[model samples]
Target: MNENQKLALVTGANKGIGRAAADQLAALGMTVLIGARDARRGEEAAAAVRAEGGDAYAIVLDVTDPATIEEAARWIEGSYGRLDVLINNAGITGSGRVSPAEAIDQIPSTVDLDMVRAVFETNVFGVIAVTNAMLPLLRRSPAPRIVNVSSGGGSLAIASDPDGPFTGLPTSAAYSPSKTALNALTVQYANELRKEGFLINAAAPGYVATDINNHSGFLTPAQGATVLVRLATLDADGPTAGFFSADGPVPW
Candidate 1:
């Protein structure tokens, strides 16, 4: 509430990795805004953070809803005056599975153009919309950070290499491509905002257990959110326009 208090916004934070990221950021003394499409879930997540003695608030933010995005920006502008961190964690798996054996041709070969478009609508365009809408407020902070939640499956270096880990993995025309675009967008935005001292980077949380994969992952949501939180709270010297994971830099 005070000018000195740092404010952060984490989208799709009703549960899973987003919620964990919000919790970690709040624990670090940030006034976190839990952005969820469902108002009830958002408030519940915020309450959970409060129970942990963290400063948090709920805001209805359906990434695909332009009206809600505008409303959220207005609310932050009026209430916080400035935003120190923006975590674009809202994402969908599109129409594919990440299993190792699932082949590229097995997926809906026709690749629902609509599904691909819809995936980009949320995973790609939504990020751009939300970031552009909040750029003004982000500029108000002396130190600003933007963390785009991306995935290893989006790594072109791995996808293109014959000997790479992901080379033999299944592919989806939707999800993977959308995330690749997201990584590129992250780089472009970070480059543009570098002079403003805004640390913008894309992070892959590794394969985490969540509904997206039917809980097939080895890691937990907490583990996934750790890298995200680290990027969210980076110092001025932290890397920008880069792609990373828990272990180290992920091929971009």
Candidate 2:
């Protein structure tokens, strides 16, 4: 690994959007670290990338596990010495979906309290944990970028609108709120890191077909990963502390 070669980390990259993001990053000539909770899945994904002629490797990374996060950081520090980009793509939808209609009331009122806690534990707190743990390594790079994978469901404008796509959608008090909090955190971190020349942004990869939704989405994983890869490889002068979609800025 030369000093000039960039290194990136993508969380929950065993498959779907996260895997797509890792593959794209590797295609862009970066050494991508595929973070997955299951070691075998991570290695398999990494092997697939290598078979496709991309530079990628696997790491055991359960976002909720602080020990695993620390271990990953130590491995990166020892092997690469610096981390140029980090895509926090790992997240969970939480429980409460029997059906779309039933999900509506279930999410806000009848949802299990433990489910909400678990959602926040992985989506919100886990991000903070990984970022803080890797900040030192990121600072070592000349140009560092952080792309937080958020969701359109978290957009206040859409969620609050009367005629919007998410207007009448189920009130995902747990998942939606966690993503919203992630967007807020992205802004705060970007603001603080701006003076240090780090570009940090939150992006919503429009509804994509993946296991998370039981393959009901209209878009593909590649479509969702496009915006993420773009943001992850942003130029030094690119926008920071902002929310964006495939087309452009998403309403906060």
Candidate 3:
């Protein structure tokens, strides 16, 4: 590996927006690692990128699995000695949770507790696990960055506004709150690392056609991945602790 080349890892990158971001980053000349819970799927995604002439590879990484997180960290240390970018893109919608193909009905009024746990396991807690594990490697980079893929549904400002785009969204005590927690995490990390020259921020990929939404979205995965890639590749003077979309800053 070239000493000047940057290394980026994207968890849950086997498909959808995660895969799109990984491929975009690789095209920009960074060595991108496709992190996934399933090894075979991860390898397939990486191979797809390689076939497209990008430097990419698969590494099994189930973000909710502590052992796998630790092992992934160790692998990075032994192989690259440092990490330039860490994108916590792995997340679950908890969609189709209660009723089949339901979103608005996953309300907080009487949502299932077990369902909430499962959502947080992957969305909120999983991000924490992966970010914490990769921090040491990130510290060693001359230019370190962390991008958390969030959603507009996680925006309280929008949710509370009667005229807001997300006003019709469900209470989503599970999936939505988990992402809200992630946005909070992004702020905390960005503030903590601000003085250390690190840029940590969150990106809200607009509703995109993906498995998470059962491909019901109108936007393509590539379109949704734009802001994520932007945040991941922010310049040294770019804003941190900010929530943004392709259109602009998202109301926190």
Candidate 4:
């Protein structure tokens, strides 16, 4: 990689919003590392990006697997020496469908503890593991940025309000709570790293049509990725310790 070119790693980049984010980042002149748990899927996604004239490579990284996370960190260090941007886009919604009726599987009243653990394992704890593993490499960069993909459903401000848009959506104990935890985690990281010239923030990509929701969402993956790409390529003066969507700052 060129000394001047930025290297970005997007977790869960084999499909959906993560894939779109990788493509967009590469188009912006950044060498994007597509992190996916599955090797074949990662390679296929990377090849597609390259076909579109983007600098992208597949990197086998499963956020839920510490061994893979550690290996990915070492590989990145050996390859590029430093990471300019880190997009924690890998996540899971726990169950197949999240409609009002289907959401019962994740309802707090009788949700399986294992299901909650599994959800947090990927959505929350996985991000922590990956971020910590990549910290050293990120420290080497003159300007490092981290974007944690969150969700509007996790917003307590909106959820607490009676007439909020999220009120109509089904209640979730696994996915929603995990994202809320992620938002809190994002703030803590940004607060700790702000002095070091790191722009760390959470992005709530409005409901996008993807496998996570069975394609029930209205927005396309590309539309959902816009905020992620924006947050990943922020200027030095860009906001940190904040939650944002494409529209603007998301309520806490």
Q: Which stretches of candidate 2 lie over 4 Å from their true place?
A: 96-102
Q: For candidate 1, lDDT tens digit of each residue in 94-182?
A: 55455545535325476767878888999999999999999999999999999999998789888788987766566678788889999
Structural similarity to truth (TM-score) of each candidate = 0.95, 0.96, 0.96, 0.97
Model 2: per-residue Cα lDDT over 1-252, one tens digit each = 567889999999999899999989989899999999999999999999999999899999999999999999999999988999999999988753312434553467777888889989999999999999999999999999999999987788988899987655577778888889999999999999999999999999988888867777788999999999999988877999999999999998
- Cα shift from native, residue 190, model 2 (Å): 0.7
Q: Clash number for every model?
A: 0, 0, 0, 0
- Candidates ranked by lDDT, best first? 4, 2, 1, 3
Candidate 2's displacement at residue 210, Å, is: 0.4
Q: Model 3's lDDT to the true fold?
A: 0.88
After best superposition, candidate 3 residue 56: deviation in angstroms?
0.6
Q: RMSD of model 1, in Å?
A: 1.7
lDDT agreement with native, every candidate: 0.89, 0.90, 0.88, 0.92
Candidate 4, residue 25: how far the Cα is off, in Å: 0.5
What does candidate 4's lDDT look like per residue over 1-252, in tens digits?
699999999999999999999989998899999999999999999999999999999999999889999999999999999999999999887886544445768878888889999999999999999999999999999989999999987899987788987666567889889989999999999999999999999999897888867888889999999999999989999999999999999998
Which 10-residue window in model 1 sums to the lowest lDDT? 99-108
Poorly placed runs, candidate 1 (over 4 Å)? 96-108
